[model samples]
Target: MANRRASERRPSDRRASGLSSRRPSIDPWRLVPMDKTVHIGGSDDFNVLFIGAGNIMFGSDEGPWNHSFRFEHKLGRRLKVVALIDPAIERATAVLQKKCDSFVVSAYQDTRVFKTLEDFVKNMAPKDRPRAVIVGSPPMFRGSLAPGRDIEMQILKFFPGVAMFIEKPIATGPKSEIQDAFTIAKTIQDSKTICSVGYMLRYLKATQMMKHIIDENNLTVMATIARYACAYESIAKPDWWDKSKSAGPIVEQGTHFCDLSRYFGGEVDMSTVNAHSLEWDENAGALSKMAVDESKIAPENRIPRVTSATWKYDSGAVGSFTHVVSLQGTNYSCELEVYADGYMLKLVDPYVQPTLYIRKPGDDNEQMVRFPDDDPFFSEVSNLIDIIEDIEEDPEAAQILSSYEDAVRTYELTWAIREASERSREAAKLKAAAAA
Candidate 1:
């Protein structure tokens, strides 16, 4: 009886009740069953081309400093090394073979060798083109100042929009080369290319935590102090001893701290930078004590034993960095400290197990946080890959802290420091002459 009564009701009564006669549409794809045997959530193949195969790419006899071993370890089976470009192909081959035999097995076995980048670009098919390139070549071979020697511009010409990982001390020839390297910054920015300079310390978890604390407290950084003491006695490379080739210790090895100082403080005022260096002297007891032969490169061409540099940041904060090449064995001492009102943050032993010591307002003692298993090398490479794939989830972690443009600024600051030290040395010589 109720059904008959409802059927008797007018269509206007159903419309007033807000009832729809049409059924909701269902997606046809959702009806299909997913195969259980197929693997899910795996990434695709990532091909990488390497421009150099030296200690920076494969690592040194001592450890994995500026090494690409972490790249393979992080990507696992997904990484494919397409080719290596180097004049000394045999060195690269041998190093990769040793790495595969001793370390984890990688796809290096199928990597082809090319004497030059031009040869690789001309010969390789479009399907086999690398999605990313790692330029680990020497400083002399990079930058635009030298017309025929710029590896970066050549790569961009051949493979536009390819992700790049360029190691630091971008170019090491003369002042002109550094200036030329700076010009590429505009090109990189214009192309919207994804580039990361090899300042891996910025990717450290401890560094991110420090940044987090700074932001949380809205702290105003007053100053940054950094020191890098290297184990110079263990350095056996002939080129490294030559100031012309390696651009001195301050530009080559000490750049890490200089870059970090800028990271903590903002952009540096180039005109305000000043520095002093301790030159190697045979008569001086401190300079003559090193195991390295000082006479090989002549006194003028040899790198300084120590360099202390200071600069003013754009934010009016002052920063200082001192690099000393006076240590024995493989233990290198490195640390950076940031200061603000009622706050102090110090990061020690950045290369190895990095630890952060923090002191806050009204705290009785400083708190210590240690990161033992943090591999920033792996993190930097992983972040680059994530960026290339457009799969980066965390906005903070996805940032490329050191871009090519930013590194050029650091390079400029390092050169300025070296020049300031040179001026100081020259002034000292004139003062001695006047006394005589």
Candidate 2:
């Protein structure tokens, strides 16, 4: 039924893109089948060409930034990584050379993918041909330092032969830019070139737990609060994380909250929003040496060390988001609180060993705690690889993952919040002038 709904709603242009290749028999229940010596799903297996080599999109500092690497690691020789990045970073380039079986360092922001493909296709090398390209760039950036049109053009060009394992908060811009990215992503949705976004939190252990809870209890989402914190300081952010380049804090950082909001409450159209900031950070940076505290967080993402916002979803659910560099909070933390029928589910610290505290009549004193973990990041990456495997086997299974279109919804939401915040500031200035 989910697949049918997706197929019925997809555009005619999108339906025409993927391949209906000869199948080699695999369990349809399992989306993408990876390499496992132990008997399980099916005997069939395949490879994929991944194009992202960024931090959150793939994995973290340890390498294999996100699930794509896990996919490759799990499938062994069957899964291939194709790396792409702003600069040919040693890690990405080295991984491509040694780790990923076949990789490309081409810039999706500058190079024309379609034109290059035409030339590459004309080449006489037998081994040069790739199975399918997975676009991991475009999204998963802190800013828009690069060009969007170029990226969109590249994705559109490669739509026919590529399956995308994109990141969440699909775009980083205002309404216009977000809309443009949406149109471009929409232009390429075919069966073979499956579209999937990195809303990895959707696969969280707590989230999975909540899915059952919500269904079993028949809870209508009344109030949902998804909070994520990046209290670290950085020396320099990626060029894209720069607000001027990326459109500001909301689009870049606040997007996780947006994605999580959508996950918990379904398609949310922000009904009301209020956003503000505590300090003009660059001023604080220049004016005070005291700003240099022990908070030696990642520098690049220092656009807003402290930020907060609130909104109401179309599903009649209210929510709030707070991002602060407070020394009090943990290094990286996320929590979601859902209120239904006076019973509350507070899920805290995800992408790790998650802890769930149920608030009800017989609850255990209603306390807040953290989720401990060992290699939690690996699980997120593994899930994404599973999605990628599904796309490779049967194009139909590919639709199960988050789509760029869905991601754009949150991007637009952030854009609106930023604009609203700015407008409120302007209104305050006008009122002050009038009194003066």
Candidate 3:
């Protein structure tokens, strides 16, 4: 970690736990003070900050999609993101040095890595503060700690009305804690901050064309089917398999489809949802075949290997989602198909190499659509920047596709599936007991 000037060091920097130690001074649900209706604007050079430095920032650089590198590419010299706040400063430094070069390295040459948000707030002057902040932290941060304060809430309490781009599955926790996090979302809304959730799929050109076709044709959607199957070997984090830490595959990985269901079918009714799952047993022969070490899997993180769920939207459109994690190697497949009157739309692999197929009435052929400009991760950050700059120019002109409030609906829908699956399991157990 680069050393900060003496004047930039504060008493708060001494905290042992680092970023997690910054408790919110304001009530989580209370709106923080906002001096202006337009918060971020009128700056030629943008000082962006990132809260968590992990795979999404570094590994993404050489992969199919990388948010940080794309962001720097779009802004060019106008961007000045010298420092990022993460408890693991050493990891951040290594990633930045390894993945980024030339201008990217020069920007952070004098970087001052703060161990905690508290230290940054106390040490940095107002002028050095960020005009925008990207939160790449895990969904687990949404869970409450010993003092009952969520890490997400702490960020909201500290940086009110600032342009924020938060990564998706906005939160992951117990039902009660999720409800609490949503309540704080209300505060974010009340503050009228320029906010965008990292539902980058929504920004894809193929997806945009799909939306345009649906709206322009005024097709009456009937039912939708979403399927996701992928080899989990590439995941950098073992916790990805754990339901408790990462919300399992449905809420964590399949969430893009859940959101797509709503995008095409309209809002879903939780009461209308039905779900089933096949639990994974480590002692089973399947584990031995896969060469998985049972000892490496955490007890609390145990989750079903396959889940199938169905639900009806408030619009009376039916939808089904199926997820399977039993595949091997790096082979993967993801598809969301919508059936509507006289037309069908299919979207594939929103994560990378996305493509869309449309079938029109009386056409034996399905037209394939691809976007050469479809770097969604690029558009995702650029869109936020445009929104922030626009709001600064005129608040009413800025409109973002996925806001915190909107993403919460998708989160709720995914949780409903998980909850319904559990209920089905309990019901099955009860029925077997009665028979015995």
Candidate 4:
């Protein structure tokens, strides 16, 4: 990373973590902090400094930087981020190299940000140190220490002063590896070194809005479908997306869907799934285009071009999600169609400003509801603040969304999808081999 060139580029003396204080320059669709209501624990109001780190595997360019910058630039007064990190610094000769700069964000992690996590903590001033240290990396990137030994030791060393913001599926390794990750995180019981996973999708405004509609109307999410399509070239990668390192598509890609399904449907049990390899898959011959995309993918990391499964939620809500990688017009695509008591809501394209269609029973068709766009960055930042402020007796269960353990459970559910897909593929391969 390049050194701070201009004096203006220097890190702000006082870093603010809580979004409640930030002054957003951008004219957001909906003015947040409009409530002027700040949620906190028993502790008094405090200024928060945030430090974030990452190890991006693929799409090294994407992570918490620019989005965060937008949060800071738009709301600089409330929450200012000090540093951003990842192995990307090794390539960039510049001091501040983030995934993108369009956000008008600044303060990328310089080279030698921290050789080890311990040293970073020690450098913090007695009071100037970060109130919360966001462990804000993608699922399978940028941790110096391996899971059990080094990772735990390093985190324990930092637990005293700083809180951590971990992204979802807490650890990427197998059962033993994940367990080790949990044990280490457990060491920091009541300290502010609170551990959090980034399950941002759960924070979507429409989701919150719909939950009310469902509850008030006594709606049952009868059956739902979640379709996610990304650039074909993007999904087929060697690192975290690869099945071996992060437990393949189920744990990697499918986990999000599983979590969403569980959110809408309650508990889910995978009833059936049919997965065949793009190369050897019987369906491959039928869908040449999809097969070509799958052909470029590694068997270990190859998410099925098509995966349809049935899930029974705890309340008898049946849900099914279909995930595929195919030619789609949008840069990225997601379609969530949920059915309930007397109406349905279709949420499309969550990353961008989300769009929703609300259809009440007996209506001629779906009615589009103008989305009251909410600033998600602040939502996430504010969420971290709450976690830091609430490190009391029982932390995990108290959180609004799923915590580390809940995220792990979601990962396990997705693991079922991955396993089912793999089995389907294997069965197809064996039959083909026998016939040949």
Top model number, lDDT: 1
Clashes of each: 0, 23, 0, 18
Model 4 residue runs over 4 Å out of place are 1-67, 70-112, 122-125, 141-153, 175-195, 233-241, 270-303, 328-330, 362-364, 386-400, 431-436
Residue-level lDDT of model 3, residues 118-202, one tens digit each, is 7777787666677788777777775343243365566667777778888888877766666665676787788887878887677
Identify the runs in model 2 with alpha carbons over 4 angstroms from their true place.
1-45, 56-64, 81-92, 97-132, 138-156, 159-161, 189-192, 238-241, 281-305, 328-330, 361-401
Write the candidate numbers in order of decreasing TM-score: 1, 3, 2, 4
Across 180-243, the per-residue lDDT of candidate 1 in tens digits comes to 7777888888999999888888877777777667655666577899999988777877788788
Q: What is the lDDT of candidate 1?
A: 0.77
Those runs of model 1 whose alpha carbons end farther than 4 Å from true positions after fitting are 1-43, 98-106, 282-285, 288-291
What TM-score quantifies how close candidate 4 is to the native fold? 0.69
Candidate 1 displacement at residue 352 in angstroms:
1.3
Compute the lDDT of residue 375 as modeled in candidate 2: 37
Give the alpha carbon lDDT tens digit for every residue of 1-436 in model 4: 3565545452231111112211112122222431343434343323333333433211245333233443343333344344333444443224234433434232332223543455556675544345555554555542224642244345556545666655566555654455544444455444434555566666666665665566555555677778766654443344533456656545666566667666666655545433333423345523433313444556545445556555565455566766655554336677787886567888877767677789887886877865555545456555556555565464432344645555655765665666666677678679989999
Whole-model lDDT, model 4: 0.52
